[model samples]
Target: MPRFTVFMGLLAMTDDFVILVVDDNANNRFALRVLLSRLPETEVIEAAAGEEALMHTVTRDIHLILLDIQMPGMDGFETARHLLMTERTRNIPIIFLTAVFKAKEFIERGFAIGAVDYLTKPLEDNLLLSRVRFYQVLHARENRLADVVRQLRRQERSLSIALSQAEAANRTKSIFLANMSHELRTPLNAIIGFSEVVARSATIGPEDRKNLEIIYRSGNHLLALINEILDFSKIEAGRVEVVDEATDLGLLLDEVIKLLLPRAEQAGLTLLAQVETIPAVVRVDATKLRQVLLNLLGNAIKFTRQGSVVLEVRGDPATEGAVRIEFAVRDTGIGIALADQRRIFEPFTQIVTHAIGAGTGLGLAITQRYLSMMGAELTVESTLGEGSVFRFTLVAQLATEAVEVPASKGAVIGLAEADRGKRILIVDDDPDARRLLVQILAPLGFALAEAVDGMDAIARTASFCPQLILMDWRMPELDGLAAMQQIRAEQGEKAPPILMCTANVLGEQRSEAIAAGSSGFLVKPVRRDELFAALEEQLGLCFQRESTEQQKAAAVVISPTDLVAEIATLSDEIRDALRKAAEELNTSEVGALLARVADDHPHLARHIAAMLEEFQFEELIALLHA
Candidate 1:
């Protein structure tokens, strides 16, 4: 009895443990309550009828129930049946009490209705207390169990959130790694490839010119890749501030197409555009918009094989004469599967099966992010082995007049013409680089002097008294920074404008250059246009040709008809050789044989050469047939 009383106290100590007593008569309910009331902190809810008992069980934690067999409306058996049917009260152990000892069948009926046990009305106090104590212990266990379940649920939720955050972190890290690989590999490719070309070239031969050309193209590609990567990182970090201005979307698209035409033609893919009659000018971040469009078009060209890559611009006439610009790039290439579609947009995620070469895989990812920044959604439709079409829309205000928007910083800058025949100094440790710079600048009407190192550059600055100095930023002895400082200290403000020519695109590199008395920075493997732009900026030098870059671009677009004409006039032996070359996919043989076909087919030769380079043998054979 002492142990039973202690158990009862333990149950009451739980405080939330509850028991229900139901009887039609007050005396019966009072007797049940009196027994339960002995337990400290235990709650006993009394009901004179089955309905009141059900209400108490529903609203409270009724762990145990004591019922009267005969109630006024719903009898104890019916009540027990109802309790088993309800979730809250179903698990509560019920004991039925009767005025008389029930027959076997009557007792069996009580058990069938989910009554835990039966007790006569003239009950033994000890027996009743023992049964109550047993169920009380069970009720306390269930309460503790429920509390544990709730705690586990909370932990599960916390774990779910942590896992999600970790997954997102992994994705970000993957992007950073992929970009770093690209940034490092692209330049390395050029440096190594060019170094090989130069190292192998002891004497000028037939291959020497081709080697030099390869080196030039590789370096240019490396420079472009580095600049793009730097731009992507800066913009992703929100470091590159955006300037919104009027932009000609049509013109921008045209520039992108022109830029990629060489690549497209090389792949033997037709590049086409469709511009619906609508306003083309709009106000946006011109540089970012251009970058986005360029990236998408570039990806389309990169992935596509033979069919046409089309850029379509269809704008709706919006309110107040504004425009909703829609841009789409469609290509015939290896399309994405449903399972990999979303994964491909994630940075560094590439479909390895469709991969033609090494890539950073950041193109579409960067495009998607740029769209999001501009509050646009990127949509894609693709089928395996078919093609893909990527699209986005922007709400743009129509430009009322022409606006001259300067390109983003670190890009080529142009200036008005200043005094010609200005003495300029070129400095670099490498003889090839100095020769290259001389070859680039000597033809520009500038009196040029060369320096092999920083010390030489400083000496030349004093002796030559140059108007501008193009110094290498990363020389071996007395680097550009120190040399510039020394020159500035000697010549004071009258010192020539020192422009750094280096591959470094870091922000601090430019900052340090300026702090050390440098005028501006020019990225390495400097194209002729970029060199002119830098000179114009510092020396006010206007280029001779107004459409210089355009001229260069026009050289890239060869007439297909001219190529057909050239193929038509080929001799029988040369034609057979060309066909054999096409079948074997030998670009060199095809070019060499075509060189003698027609003297006026220079551009067509280049086109065929490009196709041959890209291994578009099918197209090449077709062209020879034409």
Candidate 2:
């Protein structure tokens, strides 16, 4: 059909349409064909008799037909009669060619049988083509409309089918969610219940108690996974909310560090905290803030097996208004693949690696959503086998409308030990962890006492009259929050700084623990430095750092003459700068940190380039003289 339209369109321009010559006499047909050939782009088909002309009308494809009206078994009238009777050829325009008949009767008869006009013999070529082109345009337009109608019908059917398939897929997803929710929640409730029971029971034997600690840890881990999944669903559904309150930003970070250090240590990694110079308090949904930090840092620690995870704060310190503080956690673990970097932030997508364990894969997905809600964004920079730095920024409203204040010398790490002779109670369900924690705290000038559970802790609290109480939250007879509530009812305003310890150190949990009478909270496997800092800050005890003279008295001092030894322990910036100079290696096109390195450590200024190149001792000794 399209090809026929193209042919007609070509004919329309060239004045070529269909011209049929019909006659019983062969001479007449030949003469007619020769004359009509003068018309450009016209097609002439010859019929020797009326019968042949009728066949052309009924079967051949053409726009118009010319009929001869004399001398045959079927005359022009009979053929025209047949054309009109049949639906296939009825609409075709017919012009009668009659040389012998000028008879009015014959003309009228032709008109009665559906002939449009009669042309006598020796037809003019121009007159014949002009009539053919007229009908050709009419027929072409009809064919174009028919094609458009067919296309619209096909599109209508396809759209209906697609809509039906989409509806079916939605129904399947709904059903799956309903069934899986039950399967997940039932097992989670049991794990949390039994783990709490064992952790609270004082009668658990030492060997069995270790096993119980593992069980409780695993259960808490399970609970964390479930909570993450639920939170992700809410986020995907656009239902997560951030409830704001005036919060102590410094205290919040203290809890986050304590929670993450154990995981960092288990993987043999280092975790360090560097506080920003800004207002210590901020208005935020403390719960959401914590969740965002934990997710970013947890993923950093999970992927990083070595090196250090440093949490540094960056922000605008000039104004007490909405602050642009960033929490960046960096680690040197298995770095994310370049291709999977963007995909890792999407739900249910994990980097395809055998070493990285499986997850519900919503950590970063939820983290990004939470940060975005708080007018913040998360950014990452990483290289394959090199580690990643995940940082996010938030507008933290100041706790009070005041300009920045320098931390008091007492507020910042200077104080005297008034509780030097006081006893301290440490309650935890895990003995190794308890013993390890005691080892770190016992030497800080306190008589340390122990308790295996909350019941034991409460009993020891009364007898020991301890100045400090470090409590573990997930334990037996009572959980830490419940135990603290009971103890607070008795102690009233005298309640010491009761700290709660847990592994899942998300923001929501911390706020709940703090609201339930916890003066502070720490994450498990706490680092010694952080532990002491927490003890001194929360308990108001003094942590002694040896002075230069004190170190000399203890024989732990280094001589000032040892220039090489002194520079080796300096910053890597100085070391690299020194090494590059000694090796004569060109550094990056950007300016080096030479000036800053000199300002920070003046004694190592001359040796910066040598240290950067890792120059050998003898080479450095020789370079010093040269």
Candidate 3:
């Protein structure tokens, strides 16, 4: 009973234990049932014959069986044989009872039939009850083990489902970010590109040019915000990798300063660069370094309202041609509280009381992650209401002479004489986008043609026979990748070098463009210099340059006040059409409408045409509204 105690508790909590008694003699069955009744939570089913025993085993959850030999029809050996032959009742323990004295023969035959024990004539009640109790304990353990296995299987299924759902959610987030980036950059391309074109105009007055600069800077600021979010996503997905290359530390630092100089000026904060000692060139991930520096300096400028923000660098030559460079961004403004210093590096965390401007709060987190990937740690020191310094150190190899940074090139005025008149095709769905490229390349003395979509571009490619093709990635009817594949299949090596110029800024999109036979990739909001650079690389074209005086003399100055007056004199119908076209930023339609006004006033048409060439839709819209 002591050995049975543990199992009895387990069996009481579960299903009842069933015992089947198979004996032709009713009295024998009754005797076995009375003996089995002593066991707790046990039920006994009586069977008068072997057939009845088989039925009871199929219908009941039998744990053990008692069979009597020397019965009327089926003997105990035959009943045991029948029970052992079936799959369901095979594991049920059987004890045989017989009224024979042939111990040697009867016991051997009964044991051979899978009986647990053989009892003679008059069975001992205590011995029978003990065997039943032992079987009951074994049955209870088997049931508990099966339940545990079932529960484990259920948990495994739940975990698998959760993992699948998480994977799906991640995929959805990635797609959403990519699409949002493209949608944002599409219009920003026009905003930044047109502003840049206007800012470079020598005809615009100094004050007008300054306002244009503000617009240009603001457009770039929005673009940077978009990039910050996308970059954080890339880091979280583990898609970011450090690509080391020859980088000019001085030039890189200069570029960052130039980019942030206007913001510092607008904020009335003094920005300084203190370089103690640095190499001419170092091997590192220039893009990541630029991003980290930009984040640090940008934050410094943002938090500092009245004081100065300084970027200090010190480089010392280290072992194996490596230079240990330490960078520090120090700002005199409202400093971080001691309690919130560590939390600043965490994603989307901001000290509301100390913050001075709006931000995604991921800048420092991303900066720290980028530094960690480059095998460096970012540290901060700050005093409340005083100032703060964020610093990091990295060891980079000195670049060889072969890795020298090329000097910045001057502005490209036109193509070289030899490369002039080369056929160039521009494809885009947006009319303003196509006009922007036309305005840039057409004036460069190249033969430029426009296509509204990928299919149109393919048709023009064969008819116009362009030597270079600038194709947008997304479009209706067909996409850039599919169109490029078709052209490559049709023309083979005869296909022109296709530059994928689109708003898609994702890394995979760039890879896809190259794999689809694109000669190069250029993101939207492309600068005049970047477009020229891409053109030069692909077509091997040398661009003609003009000095400041020469460009100024060639420029035409148009006064917006006079343009609005000239528009007022035009017919109401023509004026309305012009305003609508300007609102839509449809440069082609506006050009056509302006042609109607050319006959009336050549001077007014010329000025308006100049604005259209510069993609000054905003100015035109304002003038038309006035």
> Per-residue alpha-carbon lDDT of model 1 for 85-170, expressed as tens digits?
98767877988888855546657889988888888868898899888888888777877999999999999999999978966875
Q: What lDDT is obtained when candidate 1 is compared to the true structure?
A: 0.73
Q: Rank the candidates by lDDT, best first.
A: 3, 1, 2
Across 499-527, the per-residue lDDT of candidate 3 in tens digits comes to: 99998887888998998889999898877
Order of the predicted models by TM-score, top scorer first: 3, 1, 2
- TM-score of each prediction: 0.58, 0.39, 0.66
Runs off by more than 4 Å, candidate 1: 1-211, 224-238, 277-280, 318-323, 352-355, 397-401, 405-421, 429-431, 443-445, 451-459, 476-478, 482-492, 511-517, 543-606, 617-626
**Which 10-residue span in candidate 1 carries the lowest summed lDDT?**
408-417
Q: Pairing residues by index, what is the TM-score of model 3?
A: 0.66
Q: Which candidate would rank higher by lDDT, 1 or 3?
A: 3
Cα RMSD of all models vs. native, in order, equals 13.3, 18.5, 13.4
Top-TM-score candidate index: 3
Candidate 3: lDDT of 597? 81
Candidate number achieving the greatest lDDT relative to the actual structure = 3
Q: Note the residue pairs that clash in candidate 1.
A: 417-542, 418-540
Candidate 2 C-alpha lDDT tens digits along 80-188? 7887887887887888878774657888889988888887766677786566556666656766786787888788788878868866764564445434543554444
